[model samples]
Target: MIRHLVLFKLNDGVRRDDPRVVEGVAAFRALGDLIPELRFWECEWNISDRPVAYDFAINSAVEDTDALKRYLEHPAHTAGVALWREFATWVIADYPF
Candidate 1:
């Protein structure tokens, strides 16, 4: 299996309650159902108030590199990325497990 993880830090002025962010979160939250390659999925707002913590996170898994590619290129995921692109910067890690 391959694990995919992403952590997002909101833009300077962006807040979790912003309508656009809410929609973006909803979009990402729907991705597991929309895509068949996902074997595991979890998304949540970060509870940490520490200086280095990201504001949001996605933890997911797929069967392999091919499945991972499909998930990344899926239209629903692309759309969600576009939405989040406007409000956050993120970091990602993917690895075989």
Candidate 2:
């Protein structure tokens, strides 16, 4: 299996409640149902108050590298990324388990 992890930091002055952010979050939340390649999915706002913490996270898994590629190129995933592009920056890591 491969784990696909993402951490997001909201752009300067962008609040979680912003209409765009709200929509982006919803889009990501629905991805598990939309993408068949995902074997696991967990997304949420960060609870930490530490200065270095990211604002949001996505922890997901797929069967392997090919499945991970499919997930990355899926329409729903691409759409969600487009929405987030306006409001956040993120980092991702993928590894086999």
Candidate 3:
């Protein structure tokens, strides 16, 4: 099993109301249904005065590191990358469970 966690900070001028942000968030939430290897998915919006912003986590109970690697290169994920590029910062962590 593996847990993949990520946090994101939008670029200066980007807000929660942005359509791109909304779409990206919805896409991430649908990963468990869209990707077989994604066993669980959850996300949180951070309404704080810190650099760390929204957070997303994925738990893969049936996938190995290789599967995670494939997920990162998957089309859905590629779309996320393209959309998230406008964000200012991103933090990610992956660990075996």
Most lDDT-accurate candidate: 2
If ranked by TM-score, best first, what sequence of candidates would result? 2, 1, 3
Q: Which is the winner by lDDT between candidate 2 and candidate 3?
A: 2
Q: For model 1, what is the alpha-carbon lDDT of residue 9? A: 98
Off by over 4 Å in 2: none
lDDT tens digits, residues 4-94, model 3? Answer: 8777777778887788888877777666677776766666676566554453333344367887887887888777777777653687888
Alpha carbon lDDT of each predicted model: 0.97, 0.98, 0.70
Q: Between which residue pairs do clashes occur in model 3?
A: none
Task: Report how far residue 53 has shifted in candidate 1, in Å.
Answer: 0.4
Per-candidate TM vs. native? 0.98, 0.99, 0.79
Lowest lDDT 10-residue stretch of candidate 3: 53-62
Compared to the true structure, candidate 3 yields what TM-score? 0.79
Clash tally for model 2: 0
Candidate 2 per-residue C-alpha lDDT over 11-67 given as tens digits, one digit per residue, 9 for 90 to 100: 999999999999999999999999999999999999998999999999999999999
| TM-score for candidate 2 | 0.99
Q: Which stretches of candidate 3 lie over 4 Å from their true place?
A: 50-62
